[model samples]
Target: MRHLSTVDLKVEQVSGVTIVHFPQEVDAVNAAAIRERVLRLLNNGVTEMLLDLTGTRFLDSAGVHIIVRAHGRSTALRVPLSAAIPEEGTVRRVFELTGLSRLVPTTIGLPRSAGPAASRSCSTARARGRGRKPRR
Candidate 1:
């Protein structure tokens, strides 16, 4: 099998929605960094967004925290923000427990971009830390 990169995330902006894809496991070790990078993107002016968790098989409370936080940010920013939780990932389980599934607009398939590409960047840098803001 081909090896995966050490990078835990990738950023892609299709149409208007910014898609942040997690390509590996997400535990306490890297959850914060993921959260920060996402928030940074939103601060940069991204509006509609989607968290692609298809490759992710694991996540902790911290991961859930970021999603919830992003949901609030999306509301305040008046942008559409949602998650794509795989049908059989551990992520769905956590969401079930927290009832986040109902609160956050989780979805499958890509959403139509609001318009033209707003921004584009595919960085390997997760940027460390958390506890600042949310992304989307």
Candidate 2:
């Protein structure tokens, strides 16, 4: 596990999946830091990733950019990626408006099914960017 200095970003490992717990707010001030860490994880060969945004209450264009870039990098690296955002909220609305929910699986909670065995399946599907569109 790793924590970004002076930031609430927390990285955890579970069954080989790296889960990133985002801070309460993601904006220009810390988006770069978050992006750097996420990209580093991917470059280091992390097989799978989960962005935990359940605690995130505020987001801006910079934050959205980070998500988009991370998704692109993960796809290019063939690394599965997912996110946890509340079913209804400002953050979720942003994802919907930006169409990110279509490209990534945004769930209400950390997927309990992310055990080692399940992560294999998730990698095949998410890494390829194949999933149902989020409902409005």
Global lDDT scores for all candidate models: 0.65, 0.77
**Candidate 2, pairs of clashing residues:** none
lDDT, candidate 1, equals 0.65
| lDDT tens readout by residue for model 2, 1-136 | 2344566667999888899988988988888889998899899999999998877899899999989999999999999998887544678778777777777877765677543221222232333344647769
lDDT tens digits, residue span 50-136, model 1:
887756788777788878877887778787777776554476567666777677666433333522323222111211112325766
Question: Could you estimate the TM-score for every candidate?
Answer: 0.71, 0.78
Give, for candidate 1, the lowest lDDT window spanning 10 residues: 121-130
Clashes of each: 1, 0
RMSD of 2: 6.6
Clashing pairs in 1: 16-113
